[model samples]
Target: MTNPTPGQTVSGTITVAANATDNVAVSSVQFLLDGQPLGNPVTAAPYAASLNTTTSTNGAHTLSAKATDPSGNVGSAAGIAVTVQNPTPPMTCFVLQTSVTARGTGTVQTGAFSTVISGEVLLAFVSMDGPGGAAGQSATVSGAGLTWRLVGRANSRSGDAEIWTATASTVLHNVTARSAPAKGGYAQDLTVVAFEGATGTGAVSTGGAASGAPTLTVTTTAATSLVLAVGHDWDKAVARTLPTGFAMLDQCVDTAHGDTSWSEYTNQATGPAGTPVKIGATAPTSDQWNMAAVELLNSGS
Candidate 1:
């Protein structure tokens, strides 16, 4: 074949062409791939056929053509070898590596869990019952071999909800959440989750709530990202349902003080997702609650 010359690497759609001349008169020209008919014979000149390489396996392929004479005599051209090379798809990066939850009086800490991937982002959601506000009622988070930063906080008349983040390496460790003492002794629930493939701690879209639905609308800053939504409720006896299209990571309750804490995540693609990412939950009772949401970017996003 003249086009897609021997040893050429082809991808997507390309034209296959051949030159043929007969003593009598060439009635038609037929194209073949690997000795099989490629399509209906061509009745016009410039003997050529269009081929979509994606339909064939990504490997070596052979191209040839046949010309038919009025007398029924057919002549075959020598086959040319070519390689099909299509682009490989990218692999999914956002994945949950580990999760832990703790609840009780005084300082609450989750059990140690091993992180399987390096450069994973660690998240902590703490809900405590006591005086409500950001003053001395908020919770603080820490871990070994990691540095934690407060992303956002929400407060209710009966309790306070806080979110913290840390960039972590592969290690075995637990997270601690201690409520400030000035809150007059409190009971708290803490949930810590680790996710691999996140490049670093991203920006918080929105946070803080007094009561009612714990939802937030945010536009992402990265093409591929991991969006997280978390909520804390005054009714510790009930479990909060995650918003639609989100996967649950962890949820816990501090039964002693009647407070609940939970977290969920969704992986976004080919975006700076422009949709309203809400952590809309189904709460059984119309009680005091707080919610927060953050967007974490992926590597090379």
Candidate 2:
């Protein structure tokens, strides 16, 4: 009897023999598996059997070889074990991140965002960090803005939406993640990152990439000092007059946010000798400036 190999459809042969009585003619041979007859083999002295390919998997099978000689003499042989193995399949996976920073603040802000197609998060790095501070951090998360608290977690979220809000008082957020159903498709990431907006500046670039995964880069621009002015009711013990290298670069004829009035300004292009200084300052009150919301630029490019 003939059969395919364990994993494949194989062919096998069975031999029949007869004593020198009469020229033995063949009667029939049978193929069996697991004590059941597979099929009839009624050809020549050497009989063959065929096995189906579908029946084989990643295991072993038993095939029996039984035959009858022309003399009507029948004999059965024990089945042999045949093994078939399946081929291993290939694998697949993906990643997504930001190459740009948040718009409001000059500093770059990035983290894993959710998928547009399935709402799955390829990455989720949002929320705030450090000591207790959330009131001033109440940001309007547009794409999916999360509120920051003292620790690196969200105190609450301003909101999320498919459409953009147009209010100047409202801060808008956009997605940083690639949609699972739209383009890239790895949605199990949950690494959150948020930037407390304070007018910092910088650029972004994809950092190092994982061996087979992708990396994202987000950069921003920011300044260490803001060109602002204030009165000398400023305390030296509680708060010193900037304590260091900071001079009024400009001043305003009026006030806006309750601080002393001032407009945005920069140093004179040519030299420090001609650098602009804050005007209208008297003794007890000094025209001054200091690191402006400088922490926001920590991730600056």
Candidate 3:
């Protein structure tokens, strides 16, 4: 055998067993799965084939090996079955930033600060890599005032891509690490929302009161917020980082779209370390209350 299994995703080679009579030379080794060929027969010295397994499906696979000898003669070969298992996704690394500076978990600081979680999406084109995207991606927030949101797609914008949005107003945006490794782990950018007032849903625009005054109405309270001025700790991950060498960047929100409010940002609290930032809706619309998007980046070979 020339090659062993790479964690259950490969099969060993067939070394045409040596025979003293006539230097028994093997014409070729055949591989079959339930009487089906997995790949072309290996004619070279090192006879082995890699198993094509992915995250979507992976498990024990029965494989049969048959060798053909010289002289119009076929010898009885031993049947060997090999198992193929699913390969794990890669873990790609990326830069982790926060909407608000002041590191640490909590007590580091407070206020309506935007934790701008920014990172570059690495593009990788490898056949062995797993799928990469925001299908199972998400984010969260914590503290006395904070909101989370997802926006944009990975590898779609420059380094300054605003993929995540943080709504702060007493509630704090907590940072979440990847739970699993994606295709080498994808690069991502997330912003934590913090410190804000009552959250409103639906639409609100200026000069809509017929008297040049701003007035809006919401049909569902699920898309509104009441707090404001919260700090953020973006770079929060949900499922896992992009595949190794492949990262995704974008944004998301925690409490839906808590932007459309009467006071919008009337009293946006101060940021930690004396920095100033605020989150509010500008001329409310149906989207200002709830919005989200995810961008994934593919890495190169």
Candidate 4:
């Protein structure tokens, strides 16, 4: 009761201490939480007990202590009220829920992808028509009762690759995307992937290229982050292996414009600061391409 003062907010493991001075020699002291014995009684000075706040509910708690003399006389200290607020454990890794891919001209809509948990993170990678400019074409995604934000993009005459993200409060089904200046003849490929346990924030690092292979690299702040790499092939080639150490999420081809788009992700943590996560430049080298990457963080990162 002396360590955690009344109305104090505590988290993690904390020590509960008390003082007892008996007229006769104090035989033992016992600490209690909400009138229950905290641990074995202490027979020495500096009476205290270790309490893990995480084990208790995150609300008001009471602490008190009792002391006894040899004659069985006991004295109890007035209970002191305190609050427990334990931190949420950090997510060890991101769990893949579902992914959907699509191809079409103008506005692109992905097929339905389901998730069992709410507050899940939805990442959409869209390969849209880029007229070879300094920047990639801007596109917006809608659906899942969430607000989408563009993470990064890579633009080239071949095509444009972009990464967008949102947090779904309810179950998500389909997603729709359209370029800022919609063009009927401009074809696009969409890949929507969902994961649970993300913080729903922007990428820790982003990288892309207008042609050839991508040299985008990201150094993850947390080991639990999801590293996403996407590319758009202007040649409309759909058959290509993903970079080493990454698992393919989804890929699509828009035959109308002869453009193909593919996405891949890895939950593995890139080592130290100097070491970075990257997509190898070997695959999909036959075509002019645009590549983009984003690293979404895990919860408690």
lDDT of 3 by residue, 1-301 (tens): 2122222242222212111122567776665554666577655433444444342134555455565667745543344444443343332211222223222221123233222111122111100111222222222223333243333222211111112333332211233321111323322222232211112221211111111112222222121221121111112111221212222222222222121111122221122222222232232222211122222221210
TM-scores of the candidates in the order shown? 0.61, 0.22, 0.22, 0.61
- For candidate 3, the per-residue lDDT at 199 reads 24
lDDT of 4 by residue, 8-67 (tens): 677777667776888888999999988999989999765667898889999898999999
Tell me the number of clashing residue pairs for each predicted model: 1, 32, 98, 1
Stretches of candidate 2 off by over 4 Å are: 1-23, 86-301
Tell me the alpha-carbon RMSD of every candidate: 19.1, 29.8, 22.9, 17.0
* lDDT of every predicted structure (CA atoms): 0.68, 0.27, 0.27, 0.68
lDDT (tens digit, per residue) of candidate 1 on 43-75 = 766567888889999999999999999999999
TM accuracy, model 1: 0.61
Candidate 2 TM-score, C-alpha based = 0.22
lDDT, candidate 1, equals 0.68
> Comparing 3 and 4 by TM-score, which wins?
4
Model 3 / residue 248 / CA error / Å: 47
